[model samples]
Target: MSGNTARRPLRADALRNYERILAAAQGAFAAHGASASLEEIARQAGVGSATLHRHFPSRRSLLEVVFHDRVEALCAKAQERAEENEPGAALFSWLGDLNAYAAASRGLVASLLHDGRDTDLLQQNDSCKTMITTAADELLRRARQAGAVRPGVHTEDLLTLVSAISLATEHPDDEQAGRLLDIAIHGIRLHQHQRAATNRETPARFSE
Candidate 1:
């Protein structure tokens, strides 16, 4: 079955088992990547392999659900950071968090990318990519309005840069990923000197 296929609502007891399996799979995948053992996940979840199979049907399905949940949490964190920090600070801080998340969740990223059948999943309705872009766009918009980011900076470019940094530092090295993110953010931010120079070069009417 396709990972995104809908199913009928599960019973209360079955729902508990399903949630347990998902939680176990998340931890296992984090530690062992996409190849983590299903049997081990079942054991950790206190469910039988048959029970896990019943809920998830396939490893891909389980991975999709787990990955989707993680993305949702990441997007929520972006919202929280936006509310707590200045526009530029919040945008850069969330980018750092996103970089760390992508680095640590290499397995999940691999699973999503390795599959050929779902190549358009990122563009699909309610997909992880769409949700992330929406969150990042809001942050980027705020930053630009506050003159924290350069005028030409785009959310897609920021996300792409973060993805590249995560891939280059592929082994869950938060310090390395964070350092690279800082560098990338510095390049995208509008420095006071640069802003002043641009203003000086513009005509008086245009500057206004």
Candidate 2:
């Protein structure tokens, strides 16, 4: 999932070609999303189609490699933020960062989320999803323990909300994504005054 872990090691020249192909694919996916032209990626990598195919047998395979390290890096950032910032601030900041990443990456994350028949690819996607969920769970747990988050808030709900925002934004931009994330974070955090106000504003139910 994270690279060529299941295969034999590449020879030096093959490794060079593999790296070039991966770089090219990354750029192309970033620029053009999941449906970027494979031929164009091969051309950009200065490799023949046969060589490109030799390195990556499928588009899904190429995409997995291109975004795997990026997801890992985001998880790593979560760890750093947890260590460096207060629980509430770290959770909100990491969500903002994740929103920005999802927006900027265009459709790559969606591609990974797409349900496919490939058994191996499905497993890899599940792994990525698990990694993200685990990272979020830890942050959310910290925030709850610190009384920064409301009780009963699940990591799955937060992730789903973020994914929805990223998908709804017309253009992939940090400003828009950050704004939406801020709104969501405000909604997620515990606000005793707000809750009290809402309780007071509710009319008494008719006795029945």
TM per prediction: 0.77, 0.70
Candidate number of the best lDDT: 1
RMSD of each: 4.3, 6.0
Which run of 10 residues does model 2 get worst, by summed lDDT? 199-208
* Clash counts for the predictions, in order: 0, 0
Over the stretch 55-135, how does candidate 2's per-residue lDDT look in tens digits? 789987787777776677788899999999999999999998788667757665444445433336546567677778999
Task: Give the Å shift of residue 84 in candidate 1.
Answer: 1.7
Candidate 1 regions with alpha-carbon error over 4 angstroms: 1-17, 111-126, 198-208
Which lDDT value does model 1 have at 91? 96
